[model samples]
Target: MIKREWAGETAVIIAGGPSLTVEDAVYCQGRARAVVVNDGYRIAPFADLLYAGDAAWWDGHQGAPSFAGQKWTQSKVAALRWSLRHIQSQHAYGISDSPERIHSGQNSGFQALNLTYLLGARRILLLGFDMQPTGGSRHWFGNHPPELHRDSNYAAWRGWFDIAAKQLVCRGVEVVNCSRETALTVFPRSTIQACL
Candidate 1:
């Protein structure tokens, strides 16, 4: 579970997409709960929460930030815990994954989105969720590392994203895509200035 819930507050999910800006991060720092996903920490080093789901990332991120928020991941072992695991088999083959402690297999950013809702943020602003290649790189950090293996057709991935967005909205979480140019259009678009 998150150390504390932000029940009536807003959350900013910082994805590693190139559209993310340092100015946005700085502006949202104290104004909203910042949930940084995976290597998003490289940009928003002062994030309120850090979530890295892939086991490989955990093994390699030896010097991640020591933020006040606890690190979150999907655990293989089933137990009563705060951070939940995303059952991959359930999400494969076009199955609809729920936010009830399990996540959709879209990507780490999706997992962080689930975590933000689970932590009780009534409003969420998605940052850097470009969901496309930028300058030959999959993320703002640069090209996809040779070691990582993530392959999904654009249509299938979009379906998964749509499902997750629907669930979040149904549960009373108002989600907005703050990226000026993002492939994800499931949620209504908003500007960082307007949100601030």
Candidate 2:
């Protein structure tokens, strides 16, 4: 079973952005309790992720040959078509975000973020989760970086993250928008260091 040490510690969901590095992983190594993998798209290259959720966000692309051989341990929260296979097994969490008018068939950090939100974290820092796909999709995961592609779900995810941030702030949960590119529209909350 995947040990959720970060259950009570500060947890950050590592998105598929081109900014992740050994330094960041090393920094979050002991500091973070668990990690949430939003999607596996080219994420397997990194492999060392320590998240409890490996939810797949790409829907239509499920048939893509690239996904056939990917592997994830019990720490995965398979979504979409994969969810169809695991839905009866209890891994499927169903449609996370209600409606934001975005092509979510391949976007959303709900499972990971929601997991962190409910994990009793003192504070949450959204790292490289600039869901807008502005920059690249997770760097330092491997020696070769992926050719960055701006997907249609960027703005939608950005809006969704903003909404969640605001909701968490209202519920007394400290939400920090550390995503370098997209700034959240939620109410201001204390930073990670402040919460500590």
Highest-TM-score candidate: 1
User: What TM-score fits each model?
Assistant: 0.81, 0.53
RMSD of 2: 8.1
lDDT of each: 0.69, 0.42
* Candidate 1: tens digits of C-alpha lDDT, residues 96-179: 333445465567777777667767788999898888765555676765455654663556556677877777777787999997
Please provide, for model 2 over 35-141, each residue's C-alpha lDDT reduced to its tens digit, 9 standing for 90 to 100. Answer: 53534334432323322232322333342335432222222244343532211112222322222111122333455555445445556665555444345433334
Worst 10 residues of 2 by lDDT: 96-105
Best by lDDT: 1
Estimate candidate 1's alpha-carbon lDDT, on a 0 to 1 scale.
0.69
For candidate 1, give the lDDT of residue 187: 91
Model 1 CA lDDT for position 57: 68
Question: What's each prediction's clash count?
Answer: 1, 9
Model 1, residue 156: distance off in Å is: 2.5
